[model samples]
Target: MRRSRDVPLLVERARAGDPRAVARLITLVESGDDLLPQVAAALAPYAGQAQVVGLTGSPGVGKSTTTNELVRALRSRGHRVGVLAIDPSSPFTGGAILGDRVRMQDHATDPGVYIRSMSSRGHLGGLSAATPQAVRVLEGAGCDVVLVETVGVGQAEVEVASLADTTLVLLAPGMGDAIQAVKAGILEIADVFVVNKADRDGADATVRDIQGNIALSERGPGEWRPQVVRTVAARGEGIDDLAAALDKHRGWLVEHDELRRRREARAAAEVEAIALGALRARIGSLRDGTELPALAARVAGGSLDPYAAAAELLAQLGA
Candidate 1:
């Protein structure tokens, strides 16, 4: 285990925009190693400053292209950017598929950009369990914006909304009909609807379909209405408009105090996840020792109800 004193030097290097130090710090968080608490303690003062943006859609909707272009756009404005691209894990090897990383190599030479691809490791909801923590590392490393691109699973990808300050649901024309889009349930989680490949045919219809659906949704006065932005990301068109819309959303979040509320909710979820992880570790320690298997046998034989067995386990943990 590393002492708390040993983490500050890495943290300081990361704060000074040393990519190797930032990568090392994030690697520790992602590995869930014993040094995590000390790293978190070192990073505690520097996080909560980056704007987290999430991008999700079905596969082949140009998510990688958009992310690449978006990074360029942000960089053009002198903002340091970090990208956490969640890729589906290879079941045999437990490694990332690396397709997204390959596409994002345009930024490989830029000192201000850091791009990391993480395997989802069979976690549902299109994100890795370590994603939020990795975002904290990037935030502490002084990224102005951290863009999280999900694994591109259709409906389950909505989890990003809870983790991101703003969620962009990307759509490409002719990928599927508008009804198919609604069935994915992406509408409910979208803070912005991006119609990519806008130079293609039917892009206008796609835009109109989204606009109509959003208009039908019920809302009160002063609600933050999601804007539809069209982009040909490959050609760098409409990116400026998309960036402006991001700024507008940021302002709206601050003006309405939504940022504070969202951060509070995010923090609460992080605490809950950590507590659950600790409980799981404690349970694992008891599994083969004495309590768990005995309880299981009793329940299996109908001598003890499952609820009672669970109560016993909880009592042991609490004790």
Candidate 2:
């Protein structure tokens, strides 16, 4: 356990761009330890400086490759980048199962870029519960841009939309049916769409399909429409265009005042989740054949409805 007294020092060091200190602070967040509140408080003032960009897609869509190229492009423009690559968890060790750390080794020698791979820990939304806090740590560390690359599990990964200032949905040609993208609800969340591996056959077809889908979806007047860009990430082709699209989206967010609104909603959701987690922990303390089972039994017997039983449990907890 990190001493609570060390939190201020960590936050200061992180703000000075000490990668080690930044990493340690993120570890404390991920551990959900007693030190987290102190760390959050210390970092709060320096947070929210970085632009968060989320990259998500189904598995095998080359998200790691795209992230590497995106980092390269952003760095060339003199942006200090931070990457949070969420990888699937190893069941035994609860550590990252994927080799994103290896894949992003291109930036390993660059002081201007910081990359961290985190295990999803069986989280269903393609991100670990600790991701938002880790992002705040990166922002406080003076990263100009923070790229959140999700675990890329299908469907549930849509949660990334709420977490990023701009969400890029990556799709590769022939990887799957184009309709699957719609089914995954990616269309609703995407601020920009990247047809990666554009050198491949059927790339144009994939782009067309996405364009057709966007046309079918209704849009409000003055709403920022999602733009599509093509990229061959491995070859570094079309990356400049993708970067331009991101800039355009950021400008639109600012112009429409959507930036403030989105961030407020994000904070609200984070607070609610945290409060629910604390409540769940308090309930867990009574799991030794206490109130929960008695309530369950009553509900099972039909003498008490589930909603009424839930009310009883909340009252027992003084909710």
Candidate 3:
């Protein structure tokens, strides 16, 4: 049951620029539910209003710093921005922030910028399950731009790209073994490859490596040729150009009907996510879930086979 009877009111107030209402709305979305119809209806009016950017990279690659600079850059352009920084520590209890505060630094107090830290929350699918919902909430709140920063959880890559309008894979210069560092999935879907810390050694090589990676990434006719942008976020270098690249891509997408395609794709993925999440939830609700523990005990005693148990669960779900 939803703990908030005033969710709709909160949603309305948030849209009216009420910061407290916005904060409360963030909490509601951060803790997601199977209420997709409500979520979709609430989000219909704001669709196409926010450009969601997913910023992900290896740990210590300054993804947070780059994201902060990007947010500042966008804000200077008079755009409202919302950030949901996904941290790895929340995977267990859905409450970890890792270095979000340390990374975001000073943006928390900005009224135009809303930033929230999310934990991985032990999701089986890698990215936080509530992440997509958070995106919708931010969009509904009228942010012109929204950023989702992943937990840097290795190469699981998860489904961030599927939820975002654009995905940026940030790489720092001199973070060596360039040839062996490209992650697939989300990395392959990058609309912009950012070589941050571009003033550092090996920056040139990193740029080349990223360019090569983009060359290998999927491309369609004039496929919005993904650009390899070099930025020294610490010094605010290339910030405007990167922003320009983002705009250029957006314009190209709008020109080619790819923007609509991407949103349709996201909507499809959202449906799939809801179906899968519901299936998992239903299985979890079976017999109060004691079926799993008892079955595990039986397997431990060698009285049953784990594979067979899984088959039974699938059969129960009509899979």
Candidate 4:
């Protein structure tokens, strides 16, 4: 664990564009040891300037390719963009795959662009616990745009929806019936949709399906109706329109107090989640047989009801 005093130096180095120092700070935060709270508290002052955009969908939708193209487009418009590509955790190191080095091919030499691939770390939302902190770090370093790319496995996975100012849900043609049946959350959370891999067959049909879904869900014309833009990301087609749609969503967020309220709610949720997680970790350590998975198994066996077990464990720990 780092000494708490190092946070200021780390922040200064990070702000000065020292990637090593920034990387080290992130390491200290995501390592799941001591100093997590201290690091989050220290970085709190430097957070929230960047607009976080979450790119999420099922695999084979070419989300990373689409994201790479979008980065190039956003940069062409003179924006400084940061990308957090959250991949599967490396079991050996309990860290992320860190495959972003190969995936984000275009921005290597551009000093204004920064990319980091994180491990989901068994975090169900497709975002690691460190993700929000990483976003804050990029915002502190003056990144005007931040893109979070998820693993894109789960149905209706919308982890990024609550975190992002706008969430881009990518879908490709021919995903078929099972994938298509995913559900309302994914469709409902999209601020703007992207029909990527548009050159493939069924592209037009997929567009219409999403359009019809959006129409069914929208309450009225006054509600922000997210537009589905087609793109062959590999060819960079429709990149301009996608960027424009993101900008339009940002403009709407700027005008809406409701969006600001959502941000507040998100912040509150983060605080509560962290507090509960830390408290559970501390209290569980003090009690025998109170580990999360064990308790879950016991509950599943009907040996103990969940509420009673939790209360009993907490009481046993004097928590």
Best by lDDT: 2
Instruction: Give one digit per residue, the lDDT tens place, for model 1 in 1-319.
Output: 2565658898888899899988888788888888887888877786678999988876667888899999999999999999998776645322333655677999999999999987677677657778888998999889999999875565446678889999998898997553374554666678898899999998988898889988988767877888899999989899999999899999999999999999899889988998888889998999978899999999999999999999999899895
Query: What is the descending lDDT order?
Result: 2, 1, 4, 3
For all the candidates, what are their Cα RMSDs to the real structure?
2.3, 2.6, 3.9, 4.2
TM-scores of all predicted structures: 0.93, 0.92, 0.83, 0.86
TM-score of 2: 0.92
How many clashing residue pairs appear in each of the predictions shown?
A: 0, 0, 3, 0
* Residue range 232-267, candidate 4, lDDT tens digits: 999999999999999898888878665677778889
- Point to the candidate with the largest TM-score: 1
Local distance difference test values of all predictions, in order:
0.84, 0.85, 0.75, 0.78
Q: Point out where model 2 deviates above 4 Å.
A: 90-97, 176-178, 181-184, 289-309
Runs of candidate 1 exceeding 4 Å displacement: 1-4, 90-97, 154-156, 177-184
Compared with the true structure, what per-residue lDDT tens digits does model 3 show for residues 157-265? 4467777777777778767643375555645667888888988899998888777766776677776677888899888889898899888887877888988998998
**What is the C-alpha RMSD, rounded to one decimal, of candidate 1?**
2.3
Off by over 4 Å in 3: 1-5, 33-40, 90-97, 124-126, 155-158, 184-187, 215-220, 289-319
- lDDT of model 4, residue 222: 58
